[model samples]
Target: MAGGGIDTRVSHRAASYEYKVTRYLIFSCIVGAVGGALFGYDLGVSGGVTSMDDFLVKFFPLVYERKHSHLKETDYCKYDNQILTLFTSSLYFAALVITFAASHLTRKKGRKASIIVGALSFLVGAIINASAQNIAMLIIGRILLGAGIGFGNQAVPLYLSEMSPAKIRGAVNQLFQFTTCAGILVANLINYFTDKVHPHGWRISLGLAALPAILMLIGGIVCPETPNSLVEQGKLEEARRVLKRVRGTDNVEAEFQDLIDASKEAQAVKDPFRNLLKRKYRPQFVIGALCIPAFQQLTGNNSILFYAPVIFQTLGFGSSSSLISSLVSSSALIVGTLVSMALVDRFGRRGFFIEAGSEMIVYMVAVAAVLAKYFGHGEELSIPIAAILVAAIFLFVFAYGRSWGPLGWLVPSELFPLEIRSSAQSVVVCVNMIFTALVAQLFLASLCHLKYGIFLLFACLIVIMCTVVYFFLPETKRVPIEEIYLLFENHWFWKNYVGQRHQDTLAEPEKLGESKPAHA
Candidate 1:
C-alpha cells in the first residue's frame, strides 16, 4: 500500500516568494491567529468548569456526588455520565456539521468573511452559555460555540499559509497553534481564579469565552484578505497591490504569477468535493485530509487537554491543585508551540513528527506504568508519585506542542493546491472535530473500563501513526504552497496516486514542479 522501494526522504524548496513581513501582513496573520484563541478558550474553560463543584452540582449532581464520595466509585468512572460528557462533545458535533458550510463561505465570500462569522457566532454562544438556566440552553450555547470553532478552524490556518512567505510558512501558520495555546493558558488562569467565586464561578468561566471572540472579531475587521483568495476571486489588480504591500516590495511578480496559475486551475473545478475523489488526488485526500487529522487525535493529547482538570482530580489532586496542574501542562504546551515555530523550518516537518512521536510514546507508557503500579482506586497518590505523574504529563504535552499540535494544522493547510484548498480544509476540520467529539464523549468510559490501559492504547497509536508519517508523508518545508504537489509527485509512495489520471484534464501537461503559464 506504500512505496515500492522509492526513496521518501527527499525534501523540496522552491525559490522564495518575495516577502519582508510588512505591517499589513503581520496584522492579517495576527487577526487570523487570534481566531485560534476562541477555540483555545473553550478547550481550557470546559474542563475546569466540569471540575467545579458549583457547575457539577448544577448540571450533574450525581457526578458532583461521585466526586466527593470517593469510596463509592472507581478512579476512572467518577465522571462517566454520558449527559455530562455531551455537554462538552455537543460542541464538536455542531462544529463537524458546520464545516461544510464554512468551506463554501471561505470559497465564495473569502476567508475573512468566514472568520468574522465565526467570531460573531462564538460571541453569541458565549453569552448564551453564561446566562443558561437549563441543560437545553447549555447544549444550544455549546453548539453555537462549535459552529464558530468549525468556521474559524477551517479558515484561519489557510489564511495564515496563504498570507505567509514560503520560507517561514511553518512558523507563520503556527500562529494559530500559538494563540490556541495562549487561550488555553489564559483560560486555565481564569478558571483558577473563578473557581473560587462561589455559586457563580462556573458562569464566569463560560462567559469569559466572549473575550477572544471579540478580539478575533476586531482583528478580522481590520485584516486584509489573503492574496491567494483575492486572485481566486479575479481581483488581479487589488491582489497586485496587496502582494506588494504584504511583501514590502514591488517585485512580487513570481509569487503573484504562481497565485494566478493556481487560481486558474482552481477555477476549472466546479465541484471540488467531487473532484477530490479523482485518483491523482488520492494521496492528498488520504494523507492531508484523513490520516493527519485522524492521527492527531489518536495521539490522545486533545483528550488530555479537554479534561486536564478532571484527570488531575481523578488522580487525587485537590480542586485548586488540579487547576494548577492544568495550568502547568498548558504552560508546557505554550512553550512547545514557541519551540516549534522557532525550529520547524530549520529542522523540517518529518523529523519533528518521528522524534516527537517517540517522545510522546515514551511518556504515555511511563504514565500508564506508574498508574498501574502506584495509583489505585480510592487512594491518594504520595506527593512524590503525584509530582512524577505531573512531570511526565508536562513532558508529553511539550512533545505534542512541538509536533502534532501545530503540524496537524500547518501541514494540511499547505498540502493542497488552490483548486481544492477550501474543500480539502473542510475535510480536514470535519475529521478533526468528529474525532475530537468521539474522544471527549468516550474517554471517561474508556477510562472506567480500560483504566491505565488507555494510556497504553495512545502509546500504541503513536507508534503506528509515526510509521505512517515516515513512510507516507513527504517533507513540505520551504515548498511554495502552489508547488507542494511536487513533493508528492516525487515521493516514493504518494507519486503512485498523485500522477495518476487527474493530470489529463488539466490545461497544461507540465510536470508538477515546473512553472505553468500564468494564463493557462
Candidate 2:
C-alpha cells in the first residue's frame, strides 16, 4: 500500500512540474508580445496622427492650408515637407542611439532588466507626447519613445530565443512579430473610432500606447531571466534554477554545461569587435550590418506604413476614405503576418523570401503602372483605376508583411554567433533605423516629384533584393544556434544544396558524438 502511494505521488509531481513549465513559457511569450505591441502601436499611430485634421491645423498649419487656403495642393507640397519629415524621422534617430546602449545593457544588466528600462522610457515618452503643446515637445516625446523601442526590440527577441526549445524556436521567436502586427491593428482600430473626436483625437491615439508599455514593465519584472544570459553573468546556480523551471526537468544539467562551454568559447575572444574583422566573421558582419537593413528598408515598406493615409489620399480618396483604406491595408498586414508565423518554421526562411520577393516585384510594378496610367490621364482618376491602385497596395503589403517584415528581424537574430550577437544585432538595428529614417524623410518629397517613378525605383530595389537572397542568404530553418557558424562558412551553393542534409547529419546522435547528449 505504501509503495502504491509513493508511485501515485511521483506521477502527480511530474504532472505539476510539466504544468508549471508550460505556464512559465506561455507567460514569458505574453510578456515579449507586450513589447512587440508597443512597437506596432507606435508605427500605426503616427500615420493617423499626421493625417488627423485637428493635428494638422494645430501643428502643421501651412501644409493644412494647402487645401483650405488659397494655395493649390501641388503648390503647397513644397512647404513643410522637411519639417514633416523631421517629425517622423526623429523617433528613428533616437532609436539609433539607443540601439548602441541596448547592447551594453543587455550584456551587463540582463535581458529582463533592459526591457524594464525600455518600458519605463516608453511610458514616459507616451505621457510627454500626450501632453505636448508644441512641436518641440512632441519631438522630445518621440525621441524617448524611440529609446524604449530600441531597448525592447533588441532585448525581447534575444530573450525569447534563449529560452525556447530548438524545435519551436522559430514559432516562438515569431511571436514578437505577430504581436507587432496585433499592436498595429489595435492602434489603427483605435484611430478609426477616434478620428471623429475633433480637437484631441490624435492625442488619444498617441497616449493610449502607455497601456502596453506598462504591461511590458510588469511582465519583465515578474519573468525569470534567461538562463543563457545568467550564464553570461556567471550566475551558474541561478541559471540552473531558471533552466530547471523553464525546461521543466532536472535534465537541464547538460544544457547548462553547453551554455558554459559556449560562454567560455565566447569569452576566449580577446577583442570581440576586432575579431569580427577577421575573415571568418566578415561575411556575417556584412550580411547583418549592410545587406539585411538594405533589404528591409529599400523594399519601401516603411514608406507605405508611415504614409498609408497620405498614399490613399494621393490616390484620390477623401480624408475619411483614406483612413479607412489604411485600416484595411493594416488588416491585410495582420493576416499575412499570422500566416507567416504559421509557416516560417515549416517552409524555411529563404523560400519565403524568394516567393514573397517575386510577388512584391510583380505587385510593385503593377502599382507603378496603374498609378502612371491614372496620373497620366489627369488628376481625376476613374473608379476602376482607383480600385486597381488599392488592390495593388494591399497585395504588396501582404507579401511584404509575410516575408521581409518578420524575417528581417528573425534572420539577424539567428545568424550571428553568441559572442558578437548583441553587438552585431545592435549594428544591424542601427542601420535599419538609419534606412527607415532616410525613407521616411524622403517619402513625401519623392512622392511629390517622382510620382510613379518612386514605385518603379522600389521595384528595381526588390529585384536586387531577390538576387541577394538567392545567392547570399542561407537556409536557417531549425539549425541549432551554436552551429550557425557552419552555415556561414560553407559556400552559398553548398548551403543551398546540402545545408539541411548537413544539419540533419549533425543532429544525429552518432554524428554529434558527445555534444548530442547535451542538446538532447
Candidate 3:
C-alpha cells in the first residue's frame, strides 16, 4: 500500500503539476544564458579581429618583420599569414588553462560566486583587448576571456539544471545552447556592421562581448543559489522556501522532502574526490567528464566556426563573402538549438546523440575529402564546391546543437548522486574546459603547420568518440531524477558482466537504496 501510494503520488504529481515558471526562474535562466552568448562572441571575435590586415599590420608590426624594425609604408600592404594565424588562435591556450581550474573554484565557492568571478574577469578582459597597444597585452586579454569562459562553462549549466523541472529539464537545460548560438549571431552581425562602418572596427567587435558579461554579473547578484547546494549546507528551511518559490506550492513538501534525502546522501559521503573513484559513482563520472564532452569537441564542428573566415577564404571566397557564409552557419545553429529545446524531451537523449554523431562523421569525411582534393590539386574552390562547404558546415552546427551541445550540460547534472554532484560535475566541466582550450589552440597551430592534415586528425578523434558513445552512454530522457542512482550502482554495466551484477545487487538491494539520491 505504501509503495502504491508512492506510485500514485508520482502520477498525481505528473498529472496535476503545472510549473508556474516564476519571474525569478525566467530571469535567472536569461541571465545564465548570457554566459553562453559570451562564449559564442569570444570564439567568433578572434576570427573577425585578426582578419583585418590593416589592423594586424598596424598593431603588431614586429609580427611581420622581426629583423626589420623600420619597414617602409609599402611593407604594410603585404600579409603575413603565420602571424595572422597566431593572432587568431592565441585565445585557446588561455581557455585550456582556465577550464582545468574552474572545477576547483566552483567546488570551493557556489555556482553564483564562480560566475560572478568569470563575469568580472570577462569585463576586464574585453577592456584589455579593446585598449591593447601591443600583441602581448592582447594575448593577456584573450587569456582572461578564456578563464571567464571556463567559469561560465561549468556554472551556467549547473545553474540551469538545478532550477528546472524533470518534464522540461532537457529543454530548459538547452537554453545554454540556444544562447550560445545567439551570441555567435550577435558577434557575426557586429563584425559585419563594424567592418563596414569603421576603420578601427575590430575594437568595437572585441569590446562588444562585454555586454553579456555585465548582464551576467548584475544577474548573479540577485539570483538564488541552487536548492541542492542549500540543502547540502544544512539550510533545510531555506531550501524549502526556494523550492516553493521556484516550483510553486503544488508539491513543495514533496520537493523539500526530496531535497532532504539528497542532503543526507551528500552528508553520508566522506570525500568527493574519493567518491568519484568508488564503483557506484565512477561510471557516470567517466561518462560525463571524459566521454560526452570529448565527443562533442571531436565532432569537428568547432573547427568550422572558429576558423570560418580563413577556411572559406582559402576555398576562394573573399573575406567579406566568407563572413556572410559563416553567418548562415551561425543562423542554422540557433535554429537547430530551438528545435533541440522542443525535441530533447520528446525523442530522448540516446537517439539524438547516436544519430547526430553518426551523421556528423559522414559530413566531416566529405568535407575533408573535398578539401584534400582541391588544396592538393592547387585549384580554387568553384561556386558549387563552396556552396557544398557552407552547407556541410551548417549541417555540422545543426547536428551539434541538438546532440552533445546541450546534453553535455544535462547529463552531468542528472547522472551523479547527490553526495558529490556539484564537485564531480565541476571536475567534469573543468576537464572539458581544459580540453576545449587545448583543442582550440592545437587546431589553430595545426592549421598553420599541418594544413589539410588537420582534418584527418580530427576525423580519427571522431571515430574514437563514436565507438565510446555506442557502447557506453545510457538513455536518461524520461527517467525520474531519483532513479538515476541505478545507472551509478555498477561501473561494469557497460561491460559484458551486466546481468550477473544486476542479480547480485538486487539480492541485497537494501544497502544501495538505504538513502535516496538528490533532487537535481
Candidate 4:
C-alpha cells in the first residue's frame, strides 16, 4: 500500500512539474513575440504614415503644393524626396548607436532588464511621434524608436535561444520573425483604416505602436530570467530553477552543468572580440557575424519592403493600386515567414539557405528580364506584363522571408557561447543596421541609374551566397549550446558534409559537457 501511494505521488509530481514548465515556456515566447511585433509595427507604420496625404501637407507644404499642382489631390502624400528618405532611414542611424549600448546593458543587468528598457524606450518614442509638431520632433521620436529596437532585437533572440530546448530552438527563435510579420500585417491593416481620417490620421498610425511596447514591458516583468544569464552571473541555484521551469522537466541537472562548464570557458576569455578573431573561432565569426547579415541585406529584401509602393508605381501602377499591391506583397511575406517558422526546425538551416538562395536568384533574374523587356518596348507595358513583374518581386520576398529573414537572427544567436553572445550579437545587429541603412539610402538612386540592372546585381549576390553556404555553413539543428564549437573545429568540407549526422550521434545518451573528437 505504501509503494502504491508513493507511485501515485510521483506521477502527480511529474504532471504538476510539466504543467508549470509548459506554462512558463508559453509565457516567455509570448513576451518575445511582443518585442517582435513592436519591431514590425515600426517598420510598417513609417511607410504608410509618411505616405499619407494629410501627413505630407502638414509637414511639407511646399512639396505637397508642387506635387498637387501636377495632378488631382489623392490619398497619398507627396513630400520632398530627400526629406522623406531622411525620415525613413534616420531610425537605422540611431539603431546603430544604441546597439553598442545594448550589448553592455544585456551583460550588466541581464537580458530581461535590457528588454524592459527597450519596451520603455519604444513607448516614449511612440508618444513623442504621436504628438510631434514638426519634422524635427518626428526625427527625434524615430531615433528613440531605433534605440528601443536596438535593445530588444539583441536581447529577445538571446533570451529565447537560452530558454528554449535545443530540439525546438530554431522554431522558437523563428517566432521573432513570425511576430515581426504579424506586426507588419497589423500595422498595414491599421493604416488602411486610419488613412481615411484626415489631418491627424498619421498620428493614430504612429501612436498605435505603443500598445505592443507596453505589452512587452509588462511581459518582461512577468517572465523569468534566462538560465544562461543566471549561470553567467554565478547564480547556480537560480539557473537550475529557471532551466527546470523552461525545459519542462526536473531532469535539468545535466543541462545546468553544461551551462556551468560553458560559462567557465566563456569567462576565461577576457576580450571576446579579440578572441573571436582567433583561428579556432574564425569559421563561426565569418559565417555568423559577417556573412549571414551581409548576405541578408544584400539580397535586396529590405529594399523591396521599404520601397514597395515606389517600385510598384515605377512599374506604372496608380498610387492607390501601388499601395494595395504593396499590402498584398507584405501579406505574402507574412505567409512565407509563417512557413519558415514551421519548417526551420525540421528542414535544418543550411537546406533553407541553399533553397532560398537558389529561388531568389531565379526570381530576381526573371524580374530583371521582364523589366528589361518592358523598357525595351519604349512604351508603357500592358497590365498583364506589369502583373508578372509584381509576381516576380513577391516571389523574391517570399524566398527571403523563408530563409535569411529569420536565419540571420537565429544563426548569430546560436553561434556564440554565453560569455560573448550578447556582445557578438550586438555587433552583428550593428552591421545589419549599417547595411540596411546603406541599402535604404541607395535603393532609389540605384533604381534611377541601374534600372533593371539592380535585380541582376542581387541575383549575382545570391549565386555567391549559395556557394558560400554549400562550402562553409554546417547544419546546427538540435546541437546543444556548448558543443557548437565542435562544428567549427572540423575540416570545412567534412563539417558541411557530415556535420548533422555527427551531431545527432553525439546527442544520443545526451551527456552534458562531453567533448567529441575534434575531427569527428
Measured by lDDT, the strongest candidate is 1
Candidate 3: clashing pairs of residues: none
Q: In candidate 4, which residue ranges exceed 4 Å CA deviation?
A: 1-21, 61-80, 247-251, 375-381, 417-420, 478-481, 492-520
Q: For candidate 4, write residues 1-520 as lDDT tens digits.
A: 1100112232233333332347778888898899889998888777777656788788867755644443322112233266666677888888888898898888777899999999999999999999999999998998899889989988897787777765566677888888898887778777777878877888999999999999999988888999888988888898898788777778766667666766776677688777666555566778888888888899898877777765665565665676777787788888888878878767877888899889999999998898777653334458899788878877888888889888887777777755566557767898899998788777766766677898999999889988887777767766555456556545445345324434333333234222233223
Q: lDDT of candidate 4 vs native?
A: 0.75
After aligning candidate 3 to the native by TM-score, how far in Å is the CA of 483 from where it should be?
2.8
Q: Identify the candidate with maximal TM-score.
A: 1
Q: Can you rank all candidates by lDDT, best first? A: 1, 2, 4, 3
Q: Note the clash tally of each candidate.
A: 0, 0, 0, 0
Q: Write the per-residue lDDT of candidate 3 for residues 52-91, one digit (tens) a residue.
A: 5446566756542421223332122223355455555556
Which scores higher on lDDT, 1 or 4?
Answer: 1
Q: In candidate 3, residue 65 scores what lDDT?
A: 49
Per-residue C-alpha lDDT of model 1 across residues 103-175, encoded as one tens digit per residue: 8899888989999999999999999999999999999999999999988988887788788877766667777
Off by over 4 Å in 2: 1-21, 67-80, 376-380, 492-520
Worst 10 contiguous positions by lDDT, candidate 1? 1-10
TM-score of every model versus the real structure: 0.90, 0.88, 0.84, 0.84
Candidate 1 C-alpha error for residue 352, in Å: 1.3
303 Cα displacement, candidate 1 (Å): 0.8
